[model samples]
Structures are given as structure tokens and as C-alpha cells.
Target: MAFTQQEIKTGFKAIFSNFGFVLLWLGQLTSQLADRIFVYVLMIVVYQSTHSNLGVSLPLLAFGIPSVLVAPWAGVLVDRFNRKGILITADIIRGLLILLIVPIISKSLLWIFLVSLLIYTAAQFFAPAETSSIPELVEKHNLIIANSLFMITWMASSIFGLGLGAPIVNFFAEKKTLAISAFLYFVSAGAIFLIPLKPQEPAKKKTHVLKDFLMGFEFVRRNQVVRYALLKLFVAASAIAALSLLAISYASQILGIGEKNFGYLIIVVGAGMLLGMLTLEKLRHYFKMSSMVIMSFLLSGAVLIGLAHTGDLRVALFLIFLLGVGNIYITSTIQTILQRKIPRPIRGRVFGVQNMLVNSAFTLPVLFFGFLADLGGILFSISILGWLVLLTGFAGIFLPKFRTV
Candidate 1:
């Protein structure tokens, strides 16, 4: 039988009216690709120079800590300033900071790391602005689709960037590679300028910025659902980071692949994430939020555990693929839930707090996992975390709110 005309019309409407979404997705693709490339480039460069996991991991630490420390203030600005302007300014600042490397790469490692630190701090402001701007660009009913598109680009960019980074960095000098990343940031800044919508004006009251920042904390404290959602996200982000910290070891030893293969392995995971995000809307119609959330966690937790048991490279790749899908769905759904639950005026702050949780969740585990990998081997350490993730999900299943959601 032919599909109904109403179904076709609804699909067409969704595509035609979502011009902002198209721009957002394209911008996200380019920016995230550059961002991921920067991460891998830093890691590879540091490892080649210092040959220590700590050296490769230092930039991640540098990036994460400032976001955690400055999130409250960053939240306030995200709310008070024009978010689109914040986004554009952040891109320009970060691009300029990265370009500082072109002339200084040979000076000292400390100088390069400091530039990375500045870029990370800039990211603190950029994240909240970008995340909070999404709901304003699309219809309420399109939140799932919008989130799906965002998640898809996020994973694709990571996989693509990392996959491309190894070859590019191998071919180009370090300074030249950094220059490519800078070019990408300039392109992203240009896109932000083209966004047609304007940011909201600041409130008329001349409130202190610190006091205004505290209001975000107070507002989140009063919202139970947002708090619960953030907690779940914390657990998920931590587990994912723990898993990622072990990937280099896993690639080198378990998979019989070299450093370059880690990038390719991540691409497999990204493929799974893209598939999951694209299908999320359809899945939501069949499963309630509660079911999807629980299943997402369970699947991710299970895959990580299974990844440990497999010695076969193909089996391991499949497990990682499943983990990617599970993680993206869980994380994207949480963001969509926040967009629905929080008021727009405070959305920036809410998301800023959420960003803090994400940074904290991912960062806190790095040292512990790095040490664990040093002591117990990467597989065992990651296996232990996989179990914790599973237990956390099971416990959440019994929460009254978890069931209701």
C-alpha cells in the first residue's frame, strides 16, 4: 500500500522549515571535526615527544579543569550576553589562540601547552552558548530530530577528524597541522556570524554577575528532574571517559593495531553513534523516556563489559560500535529532556551547570583510570568500570523518578 499523504507532508515540512538546523549541523560538523583533530593531534604529538601516557593526557586535563572551575561564571554570561555573539567571540578567540602556535611551536612545550589551556578555557564559554541556543532554533516537537542531528555530527566529526588527523599530522609538520585547525576555527566563526537570529537582551536590572551566577545554582537546586537528569549524565560521562582513556592501550596490545588504528577504531564507534542518533526519533515513539533511558544505559554498560571478554579484534570492534550507539542515545536524550524541562531564560545557566557536570564527570576519572591502566592493564581496569556502569544503571531503574521518566 502507498504511504499516506499526511505522513509524506509531515516529513517534507520537517526538512523544509529547518534551515537553521541545517546551518547548525554544518557548523557543528566542521567545528567538532577541528576540535577532535586538535585532541588527537595533541595526544599524538605529546606521545611522540614525551612517550608517556600522562604527557598525552595532560591536554585533556588542562581542557577539562577550567571548564569545571569557570562554569558558574560562564553560565551567567551565557544567560546575560547574546549567546550567538558569545559563540562567535569564542570561536574567534580560540582560533587566534591556536594561531599563536604557528610562530611559537619550536619555542617550548610549556608555551604550546599554555596555548592549549587557553583554547580549553575558551571552550568553557563556547559550550554553554552552543547548547543553549538549540531550542531557540527549532520547534518544540522537533527537539528529538534536532538532537539526533546534533549527536550525529558530534560523533561523525570525532571519528572523521581523528581518522584524518593521524594521516594529516604524519604528512604535515606540527605547526602546519595546528594551522589547519586554526583555519577550521575561522570557518566556524564565520558561520556563527551568518546565523540570522539574535541573542536575547540582558535583563534591565543591574545585578552583580557573581550574584546572578549563584542564581543558576539556586534554580537547579529547586528543579528535581534537572538534577536527576544531570546525575544520570554524570554517571554516563564518567564511564565513557574511563573507557576512552584505555583505548590507546587496547589498540596497541589487544587489537594488534598501532597508534594510528585507535583513530580508525573510534571511527567504527562513530558510525554506530550516527546510526543511533538518526533513529532516535522513531525509537521514542515506541518506547517511553524511562524505557529508552534504562535500555540505553544497559546496552552501553553491557557492551563495555563484553568488550573486555573478547580477544578477537572483530568482536572487540563490534562491542565498541555498540557502546558508541548506546552512549550517544543516552546522552542526546538527556540533553533533549533538559531543553524540554528548563525555561529559556535560564536555559543557558542550566546547560552551563550541565557542562560543569560533564567536564567533572569525564575529568575526575582520567587520573584514576590512567593509574589503573598502569597497574592492572587496560582491559582489567576498563572491565571493572563496565561493571560499575551496569550497577549504576540497575540502581537507577528502581528510582521512582527513573520509572516515571
Candidate 2:
């Protein structure tokens, strides 16, 4: 099952040399960077205006709600139409929506929420189309490297996007930052335009959307690998979402730094993710996918527990850094598994379901933990999350289906 060094070397070389993949990667880089900054900016604005963790969570809820409602239909469309068109159109619409936010920035939170809702609704279509496109653009054997490269840039953008958010807002002001994010979305659309993807053939027989969506769920139910991978993905997604909400409180209350400086902690987490991705790239041949995932769960839980008690800035940074490493390992491994295991024709539908689950994962954690942090304090809530993660990892060891992964 181990890949040869020559095979690995060739895979990496082939990824960069493939023009379609390069364009896709570039599109992903810009779009994801814009997304991170957009969310950070929204959180900052909402937090400052209302000064409540619950206020901050409201916008996050807006972001997640669309994924629940739109992703399934978006996935069906992806299978039935040209994905490149969907991707390009989504970018344009999202860009426009972001621009629309500028005029009403000073008006009302409800307007901002409405704009946020529309922006993420467009994003729902973009996400599955973008993921499914990777397999089409790259050779089957090179998928490992392709996904690795994508995950690497994903974190790199997070590092720069979140790291730059405070200064970007302070210097350019919120309106200008929104303008810059809109511009990046347009740049992403332009990159996708240059990619030479063949048109997806229409389904020979028109299928009902509800039927197709159900079929996707059926497939996941029957396929143990996909089911298990998705469960792991959900856990990882929830952990990250909850952490993002709590990081503001952790920075202000625990570390005694101002809430505006929360991005510094995120920057540290992103650095750790980048380091983890590089290490995973180097050592992938040495570990089983299941082993990597289980280990990551345990590592993430331990880090969270450590972070829960620490008040020293350096120690908290180090622990959160490890949390980032564990998060990346879980995500990257599960994503590669899904790409390899799912059938090509049904990839869009399944990934759409995945988007739903991941976003739904965001909804509960953000709301519950936002309230929990306010009531029980940040450390207590974080400790509860840490224990939950730890127990999940321990349970995985005895689950026959998971062990088989």
C-alpha cells in the first residue's frame, strides 16, 4: 500500500505541470482567502457593534444556514450542468453580493445578515463544484499531491487572511476591505475562466432532485469508508467552528489580550496547520489513513484540554498550534479518502451532502458554545469540548468499521 519515492516525486511534479489543476488551485487560493477575510471582518464588525458572543454567532449562523438549504440542490445541478459555469457564476454573484454590502454597512445588522445570507448561498454552489472539479482536472494517481497542495494553500490563505484582517480593516476601513474581498472573488472567477474544462454531459434521463439527493445519502449509508470519513470530518469541522467562536473570548478573557488581537491566535493556528501539511506530505507513505485520523483526534483533544487551563500567552499559543496541526491532519486525510472512494458520476451529490453536514456541524457548535462560554466561562466550555473529542478518538479504536479504514 506504500507509494514509492519515485511515484511521490512524479505526482508532485505532475500537479504543478497540469494547467487545469494550476488554474483550479489559483482559483481556490483567491476564493478561500477572500472567504476567510470576509468572515473575520463580519465577526469583528458584529462583535464591536453589539459586544456579545451571541451577536457574533448570529452572522456565523447566517453563513451556515445556506449550506443546509442550498447545498443539496447545488450538488444536483453540478451533476447535470457544466461545473465550470456554476463555479464562474457563483463567484460573480458572490462578488456582487459582497459589493452590495458596502452601501449598507452603516445601516442595520439585519441588512448585513441578509447580504451574508446571499453571499454564502452562492458559496454553497461554489464549494461542491470546486471540490468535484479537482478530480476532473488532475490525473487519478496524482490526487494525493493535488489535494495536499490545495490543503496547503487553504491554510496559507487562512494564515494571511486572518492575520491581515485587523490591519486590513484598520488601514483600509471596513468598506474598503469589503471592496478588496469582492475584487479577489472576481480574480478567482477570472482564474476559473481560463481553465479548459470540458462541459459535463447532461444526464441521459432527467432525475428528480429529491431522488438524486436521497440516492447520495443511500450511498453514504452503505459505504462504510465514506460514512466513517464523513463522521470524522464532522467532528473536525465542529471542533474548528467552536474554536473560532471561542477564540475571541479566549484572547480577551484568558490571555488578557484585547479581542481585536484574536487574529494573532488564529495566525498561530494557521502556522501549525501549514507545518502539519508539510509534515504529512513528507510522511504520508509511513502511516495508514485510519491511524493518522485517530491520532489526530487524540492530539486535538489533548491540545484543547491543555489550552483550557493555560493563561500564559506562550503556552496557549503552543497548544492552539498543536490543535491546528491535528485539525489539518484530520481534514486532509478524510478529503483524500472521499475523493478516492466515491464514484466520479456521483461525486458532486456526495460532496454536496458533505457540505451540508459540515455546515450543519457549524450551526449547533457555534450557538451552543457561544451561549456556554457566556454562562460557564471559556475554559469550562473548551474543557467539555476537549473531553468529547478525546472520547470520540477512544471509541474509534473499538469500532470495527472505522478500524477497517
lDDT winner among the candidates? 2
- Residues 63-152 of candidate 1: C-alpha lDDT, one tens digit per residue: 778878987688777777788888888888888988886686666678878888888888888766776777778777666556655666
Strongest candidate by TM-score: 2
Clashing pairs in 1: 290-405
Query: Candidates' TM-scores?
Result: 0.86, 0.92
**Over 4 Å off, model 1:** 1-25, 82-84, 102-108, 131-148, 196-200, 398-405
Worst 10 residues of 1 by lDDT: 1-10
Rate residue 8 of model 1 by lDDT.
Answer: 46
Per-residue error (Å), model 2, residue 88: 1.8
Model 1 scores what on Cα lDDT? 0.75
Worst 10 residues of 2 by lDDT: 396-405
lDDT per residue for candidate 2 within 274-387, as digits (tens), equals 888779866677888888888889899999999998999999998988988998888888887888899977777788888898888668888988888888888988998898
